[model samples]
Target: GQQVMQIPQYQHVQEGEDFTTYCNSSTTLSNIQWYKQRPGGHPVFLIQLVKSGEVKKQKRLTFQFGEAKKNSSLHITATQTTDVGTYFCMFSGGYNKLIFGAGTRLAVHP
Candidate 1:
């Protein structure tokens, strides 16, 4: 069995601030995927990192995979009220199954 763990179960920030979340796995991952879920909305895939030490960025958001494939991180710059949501990191466990982290809930205020 595989599991993904995330830090800072919750976060609160004023608009225009920065935020970051981390994910770790007990076992090396084949690949890792990041997702964001808006309030009362389903999760939306953000990015997937497969290669060791891979990094990807989308606008002011950055995603990184550890060289050992056992950890990952996401960073967001300049938070906004619209950014209020839960961010998740997940991994495939084969056999049509997925292991998801506890998730980081971000609350942005104006």
Candidate 2:
């Protein structure tokens, strides 16, 4: 079975600091997706990567997929209070099943 895992289960940073989280898969993934969930809120899709060694950025956020398609990472610059949330990496596990990573919870304090 394919599975996704993430590191640094939790993170805390002062406002304006930077944050990053890593994600790995037990098996090679056809594609990977990233999401952000604000406290007490639902997960919101951030982006999807289909090509190996792909990199995408949105404002202060950056995402990268490994060349092997077995790992991924998200980096955020200049942390803000609104950025506080749990980040997740997900992959399709066949049969319409979605495999999700443990997620990385980030906290930003002013």
Tell me the alpha-carbon RMSD of every candidate: 0.9, 0.8
How many times do residue backbones clash in model 2? 0
RMSD of 2: 0.8
Could you tell me which 10 consecutive residues in candidate 2 have the lowest summed lDDT?
90-99
Task: Give the alpha carbon lDDT tens digit for every residue of 27-53 in model 2.
Answer: 889889999999999999999998999
Give the distance in Å from residue 61's predicted Cα in candidate 2 to where it truly belongs.
0.4
lDDT of each: 0.94, 0.94
Cα error of candidate 2 at position 25, Å? 1.3
Error of 2 at 3 (Å): 1.2
Per-residue lDDT over 1-110 for candidate 1, one digit per residue giving the tens place of the 0 to 100 score? 77888988999999999999999988899999999999899999999999999999999899999999999999999998888999999999786799899999999989
Clashing pairs in 2: none
